[model samples]
Target: MKTILELSMKSVTLAVVLTAGAALAGCSEINGVMNDLQTMTTSNLPEQGIAQPTNKNAVSLKTDLVGLVGWFENSCGFDPVFYTEGTKENQVQKRFDTFQESFMAKQYKTDGSYTAYVKPDYRSKLPANYREAVKNISVVEDSTGVHYYVDFNNATYRGYDLSRLELFYQPESDYVYDTLYFKNANFVDLKSVFKTTRDDLDELRGGEFDAKSRSVMCYLGL
Candidate 1:
């Protein structure tokens, strides 16, 4: 009987020993994870296998617009040739009590008089069939009646034209994209867009200003 009792006690002791070992191992693994997280927090290290935003603030208006156009031209892949510097009249834009955001004047167009058609870039190029007329389009003009009409269909891909895109701002809220017909179109949010691009020329780009400041803390590891 004593022999049998001793054997039963031995089995219970072995089971307890195994349970305690598993608990210690689990605690150790959890501690290791916590330590790794702390290290990353202190060092601003990105988690393994995660991608980061590499876009820095552009130094000039051309640089900033080029990046913005680059993202908008093809769902954020290649440079789109369609954008020009925006004007006071027709360009899609956001306006706030103290701020606004919109495209600047095109590199080709200017405040002075137009002597002839500017050489077309990829963004402004359009097919003859798709050519826009002055009567049907909105454009910027000086007192002397010099104006250039935009062909909204200029940006195309794989024989498909991107639908007309425009932006408008309400001083009370965020900037929004809209069609010329006033239909609401969803596009990238500029508040977030500015955070990602971080353009230095954004201040002097000479458009409207916007008020809402987007948070890029997550991207900056703040």
Candidate 2:
């Protein structure tokens, strides 16, 4: 009886030791993950990856639009809006507000006479179809008219602009892609798209008082 009691106590103590080791190992792994998350910052990223807003005080029309286009065209991987399907009015307003901010007029030239260039997706240097007219499209004599196109068919592929003017990123349905963003596009291959250089695309922003939008436009090849 004495020998059996001693053997059982030894087994119990071993079990307790094993449990303590596992708890320690788990705490160590969790501590390592916490450290990694703390190190991520904008300073480590490139200019395009940088999210410096032009104005910190107020959100205006042009900046909002340009910002929308910039994210769709330039900062694709960075924007959290890779997924959009619900047609809530608030969602539409959010997209409109974004497009209202990011595009600039220096890259987007407009005349008293305006024509709308629409593309559903950002394929390459050019769009599949460049339709110059749309009924009830906004054409301002002083303000250049903003054209709208829909990329309702294909919205899930890379190198595709994925921005429509009057619509969000819909899986299926008539969508409107805008020229506001496309008009200011500068094309480069996958390698050089985000490459850092003196003449990098980040220099495209301006405070000269120009129109900006969140629409994704095709490349004009600067």
Candidate 3:
């Protein structure tokens, strides 16, 4: 699975950059940009974490999901810092490395691979009109751990409706293990879907920055 960074880098065009620049004018501060990124990614979602829980509460799950989605959409996806005007590449790389190390599970620190915890084609399955396609969310807790069930709208996998996502939350470590469940009992281990390496990030940074690429930086408020 290609990282969001890889996909966005390859697909960003000059026209898109220009349009985004005009649309995002006055979003100069990095914090504001981050907030905009989150809003852009999750604006269409319904209310989440409405169900009761025993171990981890609804608030914790909601916060974690929001943070995870925001990080995935912006920093992992477009990486505005990489395109920030006058910022050195090394500085951006260091920040990216630090963020990844802190956000990801400790296993990734030693294994040298970042687990996305979602299907490789999950984004592709989302309806074009929907920003965050999550239809509804319910949280529950049993003796094992806290569980979050996330339902999707108009999505299917292997001829079966892609109905639910089960997130097993570990309270001690504050990590989530996710699984995608289909209507027919078929499921995918989201943890096994994609693994990103530092080498991949390095290769992304090594790409040639052409005139259009520089224009993106300028348009993103430099």
Q: Which candidate is the best by TM-score?
A: 3
Leading candidate by lDDT: 3
lDDT for each residue of candidate 3 in 36-143, tens digit (9 for 90 to 100): 656654543324432222232111111123222222223232455545667554344444344223322322446564333333343444333332445665556666
TM-scores of the candidates are 0.21, 0.19, 0.27
lDDT of 1 by residue, 3-23 (tens): 111124576456556656678
Ranking by TM-score: 3, 1, 2
Residues 15-110 of candidate 2: C-alpha lDDT, one tens digit per residue: 556656678666666566446534433223323322233342322111122323333343332223323446343354355444333221212346
lDDT at 55 for candidate 2? Answer: 41
CA lDDT of every candidate: 0.28, 0.31, 0.38
Q: RMSD to native for every prediction?
A: 21.9, 20.8, 22.7
- For model 2 the local lDDT of residue 63 reads 14
* Between candidates 1 and 3, the lDDT winner: 3
Query: Which of 2 and 3 is ahead in lDDT?
Result: 3
lDDT of 2 at 211: 30
